[model samples]
Target chain A: MRLINQRLSPGAGAVLKTLPFVALVLAYLLGSALRLAENPNDKLLPALTTLADAIDRMAFTADPRSGAYLFWTDTLASLGRLAAGLGLATLIALLVGMAVGMLPVLRALLAPFIGFVSMVPPLALLPVLFIVMGLGETSKITLIVIGVAPIMVRDLAQKVLDLPREQIVKAETLSASTWLIGLRVVLPQVLPRLLTALRLQLGPAFLFLIAAEAISADSGLGYRIFLVRRYLSMDVIFPYVAWITLLAALADYGLDRLRRKLFPWSELEGAR
Target chain B: MTALSIENVWKEYGDQIVLENLTLEIAPRSFVALVGPSGCGKTTLLRMLLGQEQPTRGRILLDGTPLPPEPGPDRGVVYQRYSVFPHLTVLGNVMLGPELQANRLTGRSFGAARRALADQAREMIAAVGLAGAEAKYPAQLSGGMQQRLALAQALMMKPRVLLLDEPFGALDPGIRTEIHHLMKRLWNELPMTVVMVTHDLREAFTLGTRIVALDRTRSRPEELLRYGATVTKDIAIWPPRVAGRATLYDTEHPQAQDDLTAFASPAGTTRQTPSLI
Candidate 1:
């Protein structure tokens, strides 16, 4: 069979997808066994049992000092910040992006500034955000927003600009005012694109959130990970990192589902 | 009913003039087709009529009043594509104009008002032969059906003038013929003037009660910037199809009578036996 023409059955495709993941686990186990066999006291490559024990200690058991499960607490704290930052970013991106896109005066005023801000490395502004907003939850949330909002705004504005000019002209002929045009013609179409932009910004938002948490947070996944690094708790650190990755993946899947549910017409557009 | 009068309109984009010294008097219920080759500014003139682009010079009067500077519900337009909003379903798209007109703030009607709007929209949809596809989005519709929905959407506004920029140019031949009949029926039924722009001469002859051809007198690149396209031929259809009342013979230009002799049927041919169709 030709390579491009070859097709996999559903059962075969499922197994093919699992093979690499299973192989990675097997490779890790083999390496851990070899390292442990050489040095019984080694903390670098803990056995699977040690990792499972750490998961139980962090997740099931309560911390002696705080009397709360650190893993659950950290997850909740991080998730709360992520939601707030993302929600704020979405609102700002919609309003400012629509203004910059639909109005020539506003586009001239803000489009260049947004482009310049988006070009700046968001991580470089972490210190400034922390200093201005302080070391509270506000600073951490602001870091995520500052990291993602400009890019999201730029993306949504471009989406608006790329819309067919005929649609706007048609809307105007329908007696639509400027505000009505934005609300009816532009907003509904730009919404799906906004969700897409939000999906793409998730990874960067997480990076900024973790960076902020690692720097000065009292309780978060990143804080917990950085706090235990001195003691070299690789077992707990590995599970925390995996947990974060799982959360991000789940959020991405949920957003994709929401977009499909809300804007089914966009699927036919083959929009990115 | 509304009549449109264009007096010596000129459209120039910087150094390049698109249209020059164009003048036309569109009757109250006439279907005037602006036919031209590409870049000859038939679409530009249509855009000017639709209030999308203002004439760089000269004037356009609707019902003897100066046209509003921007597009309004007083005029409706259908393009070759993107005439309907994809985000809205067939019913929603049809009702949008009325909804926005009734409620400026929300652009929506509610309760009994919305129900009434839906009924009118459904009636318009049925008029365009799209009765069963109310819930379907524009993306779910075929090109012909989308154009039908666009016609319904534009008609829902009941504008004084309907501007079509090759509204059926994107449809297949079979669909185009079907929609041409629908277009003719709508023009006959509604009280509005139509100005359509098409590159297809057969389409112009098939649907237009009067055909106006535009072309440049000069062809050189340097002359192209200095000179612009103007009306080269203006021919009125024989056995004239007028709606509501008979049109007087004075509307026909005697100078263009000899121009359409090559395309028209023989002198003794019946009214139904025109060669252009």
Candidate 2:
């Protein structure tokens, strides 16, 4: 009990730091609940009520087989697209980021172009992308890439630029070649920052994915929500949204654990 | 033959000249210390020798050959700051040089190269008194330990010439003394040509077998001042005996040796025996 008290005392500042996030979440939940209570028969009200019912059903249900399989399948399909898009984005972004970061001329020439393109919203490009690539997986995947790659490139490049120059000079003194210095000295320092950036971008990546899907796709979570909204089938939309939130939370948590494991020095700092 | 020679080396930053017409020669297996006031171009000279910078005029030659544009395995340098890569473990930093140069492993086969390099790195680390720090990163170690790791990394390359630019300047006096002793012992065992720059007179006296002072003056030849003393057992002995030469003591006068010994002692030492040899 004494140890717990001491730990809590030190965490008082951290608790205060998180107070706003907690307050925002509480306000959101209370507002939605009050709105549902005031208009139980309204279109939006049934959707909100259906969301509550779905949460209750999923939380209390003993058997997963009782629920509709469409929700689960659509969830899996959405997750698969996300995985594919993010994986491709990560690979391409890393290559481009490393190249630009290491070479000054390349960075200067390409950075302006990338910055300008990143500002153009992916949704705004959807009509054009659909005209060119059609409403297929290619267009959707291309949208994901356009949305995620620029941020990845900028973040990773900045991290590379911020690497301690002394270390690079030391490597050069040791006669380390360009490739070896990049792989051994540069990459490890940037990995933690890259992982952190990737985790932070997860929420936006999912947002863009849903937006892309709603614009054109007839499958995945976004399409499911759109299809069900026509008949005011709030129960279906609620389950899908809830599942997406759960997936996002789970992914963020997994990345956090990975970062801690990979960087034990940061973990030590956290302990302090 | 001179193992290393610098002739009329000039370094300028815009309008300011750091080194003007500086010339020096270091013989094989000799320890030469360069000592002067701060910003006197001692580091500039070291950097030029290491091929990190090119002199505005003149050239640095290793074994009568002009130095290459880039630093090679022929010269190893240790900086005052702990320059070991913070992201790599101690072993990784030490092994990087050899792994990059000799092994040339590609792709997944780097694992085997890394292991072999790690073994040699462990030996070098132990030699430098960092026996169990192989797995630890640079940030986890103290400043002295990090400097030692840096030295180990340099030594593992086994370069013919070792260049240290005030390697112990940033360390505390006690740790500085320890590292100085360690460096002296290493030099004695390895017997490589070494050129070190330092501002600490005591450090120069302790580590240098021959010390040279640099005088940089505009429109004048750089003066090289050699201290003709040997410091041993914390006592400065007078008039470094010319190699393979004999010195006759003037026992009848005694004042000759007394005068010489008085000149060798550090400024604060009190002289009680004015006439005694």
Candidate 3:
């Protein structure tokens, strides 16, 4: 606890952060070596060359029938669903959250319903959604929305309510209309929080999106990985899982940068 | 010269009454400092004047006209915090008033009009002694600077009345004095109605043309909150001094054991609200 509390120099901090990543990679290599020594034909833990060949075929070569690169196509398909789902969630959260936060009537009416919806496991509704929406793009997108929207709405509504009450009164004195105060004062303030919320939800979103795709979709990273799972193709699965991690990390980093740029004061506030 | 009036106003939160039949009249160009103990509803009264809170049964009038149900550009306010938007730069925060007002009146705030508004905002920023720091966000500003930026933002709206709730409560003594000077100059130049709520009686004595304090007169602990608070002391200070007035208010303050229940002003009305006394 004492060591964690003490601040480290920039260089030392960087090195400490990279230490665990390096250890993980080294451990995986050693495990692969030990397994391969036991059985060279082990498909469970294929050699590095086997994984590289799979990547080249999936990434570089176009499918003979469809004339499309599987890796890129799968990435585009998956990212599209994630973006659309997140976009829909954000819109719903802003509208519903701000209303519930600002208006007592809205809060009394919808806040409980949103809370109830959030408590229900989103994955449980996937079957219902697929059945009703017919396993199309809408079903996949709706699954992501349902999985994240309720949580976002609840989080954002609480944030709005937590806003210093004086600011609301101050904005009122400035002649700001109800819509203007929400759009101008409240909207800009909550955006960084929303981004932070989005970054946190990356895990659950990926889970729901992948589950939907695995169960129904013809094309997606999850679809491809689950399709080859019958042969126990761990090589392709490993890289695909790693790709998801990389993508989520990149997204988190991107949002952090954008938040810092657009809402510098939020950083100060968070520190306080 | 009656710019604002609160006639038999009362406010309550469920079982607790905060303000009880409060009646007051503010002149068109007067600096009124409201002083009270903690939980005396001075801040509540300020909010009511700004039209942020409706009086439970009474009406508020501005220039003999009933105040609109909601707060508008007719009134401006500064709080202890949330006085400035953290997301905007000093210039942006000050400019928000003009941009919002312009957009409301003319339905457009683009091109050269915005540039002109920026120029005005820059002038207000400079007036508050924050010229070089216009581009800095609120977090980048010192406590005093942020308050000054807040003042600039509120003043830019050109409000008929300005309400401040402990605007300098968080500032150091030195900066607070500087702000006091700035406020004196602004009030000297403009004839806008200003009401400030403060816990410091000395501050109220020095800054206000008239000072009013709120407290319960009766000493029953059980009925303290039920009875709530009403205006106890209202005094007019003569011969307004712009600068070097610190010596005037620094003479003395109520000692710790003075018992505000027995407190009353030397001059002006020591009168209670209605028949409370």
- How displaced is residue B271 in candidate 3, in Å? 40
Better of 1 and 2 by lDDT: 1
RMSD of each: 5.6, 8.6, 8.0
Poorly placed runs, candidate 1 (over 4 Å): A269-272, B245-277
Candidate 3 lDDT at B188 equals 62
RMSD of 2: 8.6
Report the number of the highest-DockQ candidate: 1
| Candidates by TM-score, descending order | 1, 3, 2
Using all chains and alpha carbons, the TM-scores for the candidates as numbered come to: 0.93, 0.78, 0.88
Q: Candidate 3 chain B: worst 10 consecutive residues by lDDT?
A: B250-259
Model 1 over residues B1-277: C-alpha lDDT tens digits? 8999999999999988999999899999999999988989988998899888999999999999999888999899999988998888999999999999999999999999999999999999998899899999898898889998999999999988999999988877767767876887788789999999997888888778999999998988779898999999999998787865445431322221223443344445436654785
Candidate 2 per-residue lDDT, tens place, B1-277, comes to 2389887777877656667766677777767888876667777788888887898888888999999987777788888774676656788778878877774443112677677777878988988888988888777887778888988998887888889988888888767766775776677667478888888888887777678887543323332221111111222224542222332321112211213343444445555657766
Clashing pairs in 1: none
> What are the per-residue Cα lDDT tens digits for candidate 3 across B129-214?
88999888898888888898998999987887889999999987656766776777677666588899998777787678899888
Model 1 chain A poorest ten-residue lDDT run: A263-272
True contacts kept of 3: 0.57
Clashing pairs in 2: none
Among incorrect, acceptable, medium and high, the docking class of model 2 is acceptable
Expressed as tens digits, the lDDT of each residue in A1-272 for candidate 3 is 69878988999999999999999888888888899999988888777888998898889999888999999999999999999999899899888988998889999999999999898888888999989999889999999999999999999999999888777777766667777778778888888888888888888899999999999998999999999999899989999999999999999999999998887778885222
Share of native interface contacts recovered by each model: 0.84, 0.43, 0.57
Clashing pairs in 3: none
Q: How close to the true structure is residue B144 of candidate 3, measured as C-alpha lDDT?
A: 86
